[model samples]
Target: MIREFFKHLPASVDPQTRDLAEQQLVGYACTRRPDDFAPLVAHLDSILSPDGDYDEDEDEDGKPKPKKRRDAFFYL
Candidate 1:
């Protein structure tokens, strides 16, 4: 199933992005917890979605906010 998911990624996606997505997918799959799957899918959706920039968080001055480190999750 994970292979199928990676196989279906759009051809237009660059190699680096595709590689990152595949890595994240694999990491998520290793968790084997059903609940973790949704966030993994949501992350992939954000990457593939065309509506807006993937990095949407912003600060008060409208500048892009620094991404917070996910200390609890090694994959992150």
Candidate 2:
């Protein structure tokens, strides 16, 4: 799966790089069917965490609490 592939890749990769890759992939899909990319758009939205207040503390798993989601989605 793409998620697992990403997980196995170097974690040091910049987030912007990941975002660019996603955008390119979505763009590629749009080229195949001009009128039916809505579902793919929704799936992209689901990958992102929700916005607003977040805890700065780390969880028991030592992971930082999820931060408030940003406006990564843009309408053009």
Candidate 3:
């Protein structure tokens, strides 16, 4: 899911994890079909710039919370 990739993307994550996330994102970015790629970009935008309010102090299992919903969906 996008949340997993999003989690691995932050600089705080281990370098190996970030590298794998980057590989997944970069591989998808090279897709020949714009239609297939668009949702990934849109989903990233949704997660990065979510539309609703958030409680910065909130944490789930000691990790920052992932947003609950978004309009876009990414496909592998």
Candidate 4:
């Protein structure tokens, strides 16, 4: 949906501005399902990056921490 939003954004708006808006929207969606989205959310910057896949430090155990899982409809 956000991709479509940016695709249909006004021509007057700059690409950078549109990208920021898309990121904000995606961020909101991620917040809404942090656990479900955590894998993607954790990689959001990379996902949004032009080159993709930035380097990130591992946790103390040198393992990527798993996202906490929660029911998708928990809030309802």
lDDT of 2 by residue, 1-76 (tens): 2342244334444799677756755575667453355445445434442222344679899999786443333333
The residue pairs found clashing in candidate 1 are: none
How displaced is residue 35 in candidate 4, in Å? Answer: 17
RMSD, every candidate, angstroms: 10.6, 9.1, 8.9, 12.0
TM-score of 1: 0.48
Off by over 4 Å in 3: 1-9, 32-35, 41-76
Q: After superposition, how far is residue 31 of candidate 4 from its true place, in Å?
A: 1.4
Per-residue lDDT for 21-62 in model 4, tens only?
A: 667767777576645644443344334443332235467999
Query: What shift in Å separates residue 54 of candidate 1 from its native position after superposition?
Result: 19
Candidate 3 vs candidate 4: the TM-score winner is 4
lDDT of 1 by residue, 21-47 (tens): 878777888876756675666568556
Q: Best candidate, TM-score-wise?
A: 1
Off by over 4 Å in 4: 33-76
| Candidate lDDT (C-alpha), each | 0.60, 0.50, 0.55, 0.50
- Candidate 4 structure, TM-score to reference: 0.37
Query: What is the per-residue lDDT of model 3 for residues 1-76, given as tens digits with 9 covering 90 to 100?
Result: 4454464343445667556656766788776465776667556545544543243555857887765543444455
